[model samples]
Target: MNRLTAVTLGVADLEASAGFYSGIFDTPPNRDHDGVCFFPLPGCWISLFPLGHLAEDISPEVPKTRSGFSGVTLAHNVKTKDEVIAVLERARAAGAAIVKEAQDTFWGGFSGYFADPDGYHWEVVWGPMFDFTDDGALLFGKG
Candidate 1:
C-alpha cells in the first residue's frame, strides 16, 4: 500500500478553519474547493471538509461521536524544545486553545498540546531520541 498522504479534519466553518490553520502553519491553502481546503505538510497534508460532509462520508462507520477527543491526535515534532514552545505560542496566537503547556516529560522529551478551531488536538514535541531523515521527516529507526 502507498504511504498515508493526508489527515483530514471535519470542520464546522470552512473559512474560519482555513484562516486559523493558515496562520498557525504560516502558509495558505495549496488548493481550495467548494467545501474543502488543503494544507501541505512535510510528507503528508491536511484536508479540511465540512463536518456534515465528513460525517456523511463516514456514516457507514458506526459509533462516530460528535464531540470530544475523537480518540486521535496529530503531532508536530520539532528539533528543539524551543521550537515546541514557539509552535504552541503560534497556535495560541492563531486562536488555538492550549490544552497543555510545554513541559519536560518523564520520557525525556518536551511537548505540549493545542486544539484548533475545529477541536482537533495537536501535540508539538521535541524528543532527543527521535530519528529523522535528511529531508526533515521522522524516521522510525532500524528494526
Candidate 2:
C-alpha cells in the first residue's frame, strides 16, 4: 500500500523557506540541516529542499520555469472565520503572497489563498460542516 508521506517544496533558499513556514505555522522544524528542513503537520510532513538539489534528485533533465499553477494547493481548515483571517494575516506577514483574501464562499465556507515564495499555493479555510482538532486534524464531517 502506498501512503502519502510528505509534500516537499523546492525553494531558492532552504533556511528562508523554513523560517517563513515556521512563523506562519507557529511550529519549529522537526529537523533542520544545511540543505533541508522538515515540519511535521497534522497527518503529513512538509519539507523544504534547495531547488537545485530537488531537481537533481528528481532528474537532471527536468526543466525549470516559473509559469502556471502546479495544480496542487494545500488546505488548512480552521474552526472559525476569525481564525481564517488571523492565519491569513500571519501568512502575509511571513512574506507569503495573498493570492485571494478570505471571504465567504458559495460552498458554505470561508476561505482564502496564499502563495509561498516558490509559488506553491495554500488555501486556509473554515467550513461550518466540518470540525477540526487543535492539532489540525479533521475530527468530524457532515456526512
Write the residue-wise lDDT of candidate 1 on 1-143 in tens digits.
Answer: 78989998888888899999998888999664777899987788899988788888878663334677779999998888999999999999999999999999989889999999878999999987877777777865423
RMSD of 1: 2.4
lDDT of 1: 0.87
**Candidate 1 regions off by >4 Å?**
60-65, 141-143
Worst 10 residues of 2 by lDDT: 59-68
Count clashing pairs, candidate 2: 0
Residue 3 of model 1 has an lDDT of 96
Clashes of 1: 0
Candidate 2 local lDDT, 1-143, one digit each (tens): 78677988888877789899998889998774667888888877888888888888889897544467989889887889999999999999999999999999998899999998889999999998887666777765756
Per-model lDDT: 0.87, 0.87
Q: Kindly provide the TM-score of model 2 when superposed on the true structure, using C-alpha atoms.
A: 0.88
